[model samples]
Target: MFADARKIAELAWPVLIGQLAIIAFGVIDTAMVGRYSAVDLAALGLGSSIYISVYIGLTGILTALQPIAAQLHGARRYSEIGEEVRQSLWLALALMTIGFLILYFPGPVLRLARVPAALHERTLAYLQILAFGLPASLVFRVYSSLTNALGQPRLVMILQIGALLLKFPLNTWLIFGGLGVPALGGPGCALASITINWTLAIVGMLLLTKLDVFRELAIFSHFCWPVWRRQAAQLRLGIPMGLSYLIEVTSYTFMALFIARFGTTTLAGHQIAGNVGAVLYMTPLSIGIAASTLVAQALGAHRHEAARTLSRHGILMAVLIACCYALMLLVLRPLIIEGYTPNLQVAAAAMPLVLIVAFYHVFDSLQVTTAFVLRAYKVAVVPTVIYAVALWGVGLGGGYLLGFDVGGAIPVWLTGARGFWVANTASLAIAGFGLLIYWRGVSKRYLQVDAVGQVR
Candidate 1:
């Protein structure tokens, strides 16, 4: 158990760092744009919510490549790994087209939020520019996922840290205007993201071509047409995975949309709270990814017991770390929200939400780790149903009734963004427990099968 924990940490730390760097882009945008203009800040909040939903949904599909590649690497099937990479790229391109169209024509969805005219135009522009970067973003996701599954998270980490360094300068210049560049405000963040994403994609591909390890697999040696059988297999796993992500993200996405009705101050506050939650999520998410990679590889090698052990350790570590984080967040809630904006009202509005987010971290960690582990087992469909019922049905639906005070039963304290935050916290708890129970059942079944085979 101790040795397994170390292995998880060895792989998880780099992924944690890389994920933090990626998440910083949003944090920087929120803080910098919050200072630029309240309107821009609100637009940033709304625009990013929509963009994240689209991005996560699409990338979730590409993530199917991780387990497939990890298992292949463990089985020592080097050549087959290359073909999976090719098929994934094909899938990425197709998904990109769908994502791009949704982002480009975001008006229909934006209407659901009923964003005021002051924020709508800028939010629309933000989504449109992000649409231009969707393809590059998806391409880099393929690179990142492939590297991670092969136990090469450091490769992705280095690039992410580099992108973050670039992100600060670009965000500063484009957002506030400098070097003879006119300030683009909130939309500037989107522009900077596009530039950075494209750079990462191009350089990542170049590295794949030059890297000794990657070269061994000949990932780019030849272009093969999409194989329907492989594509179908990928989609079979990828679609539920994608929908699971979509359901989880859109639950929060809809929260932002519904909270928009409260006012810009409240919405901006929600963004701050949400961004902080995302930052804290990196640690557990990295652990989940590391464990998933190792588990998939172990299963591939027919070491089912090892895979089960790794999953158990990963969950234990994530929950413990999350508890520590939750305590720290509760203690520092005020100081943290202060950094996001100078507006007293916004900061005050975010206080309770951040307080709730502190505890939300624990449940968030639980659900995410279990979800990723389940994916490694190629058991996605059940989790998707769990998420949809828990996050969407429970989280979103409950938030609506509480936030809107449907029939006027909600308490005064729970009638606005507070209501939404409370509901989401509860929903995470539900989703986490549900996924954990399901994971245990799956593990038990796998062990039973192995035992029966051994007796035979």
Candidate 2:
């Protein structure tokens, strides 16, 4: 048990740091932009909704590389890993094009949301500037996925933290206006992100090319054209993975949009709570990533018992840590809300939501950890269906019904943007339970496999 814990931690801490760094990027944006004006803060919130929907959906597809590469690494099929990396990049480019189209022509969502004229143009600018970095961001995803799979999460962590470090100064300069640069507000953060993303991509490329850890893999020795067959194989796994991510992210994104109608203070408060929830989520997400890597590798090596042990221990680790985080949030909820903004209304609105997160975040850990482990087994389609039903159907739909007081029974406290979060929490609970059941089946099947790896 101790060994399993250590191994999971060994991989998880770097991933946690890296994930926190990424979340810090958003945190900085929220904190800095909120002080600019409620209008720009609201724009940042809305724009982030659209951007995260696109970015997460696209990057989620490329995550197929992690399990695939990890399995290959465990099986000692070193050379094949490079080819997979190249193919993932091809997929990334294709995904980048699709993301650009969505961000560039966000007519449907914008129309659906009916953003006010005061906020629309700034929101559009934020999304558009962010669109320019899609290519670099996707490439960076590929790099991060590959190295993490290779058991080199520290490499990815270092680079991501560096990007986070650079983002603050850049955000200040571009956002506040200095050295002849005009104040650009929210959109300026997007520009800073674009620059940081490209820089990370370049650094990742150089590292992949030069590092001994990756040398044997030769990930970029020669550019290979996209092979249709290989692309299809990745798509088979990638598409459902992507859709699951889309479903999860869009649920939150659309919640923001729906909450937007309530007023800027409500939206800003939601943003703070959402950011807080996201930061807390990174703990389980990192554990899941680490566990999935180990799980995939164990399966590839035909160590079914090891895989089972790691999965159990990993899930436990995430849940336990989540409880600790939730406890901390319960105590620090006031201070945390204050850190986001000075606006009294926004702070008041966000406090209760943070209180809810204190509990829901536990289920969040379960769902994310189980989902990532399922992905290690290449079981994504069921998870996709599960997310659609749980998050989109129950969470989003229920939130709409309750938030708008559609049936006229919602309590006042639960009838505003707060209702959306309550619904989302319930959704995570459903998802967590659902995934837990499914993982049991997967583990049983995996353990049933014989010496030649044929499931009995």
Give lDDT for model 2: 0.89
Q: What tens digits encode model 1's per-residue C-alpha lDDT throughout 373-424?
A: 9888888999999889888888999999999999987899988998888889
TM-score of every candidate relative to the true structure: 0.90, 0.90
Candidate 2 lDDT for residue 231: 86
Per-residue lDDT of model 2, residues 265-356, tens digit only: 88888888887888888889999999999999998897877887898899989999999999999998888888878989889888888898
User: Superposing all C-alpha atoms, what RMSD in Å does each candidate have to the true structure?
Assistant: 2.7, 2.8
**Lowest lDDT block of 10, candidate 2:** 447-456
List candidate 1 segments past 4 Å from native.
31-43, 110-125, 172-188, 260-269, 334-351, 407-416
Q: Candidate 2: where is the Cα deviation over 4 Å?
A: 33-42, 105-120, 178-183, 260-269, 331-351, 405-418, 451-456
Model 1 poorest ten-residue lDDT run: 19-28
Clashing pairs in 1: none
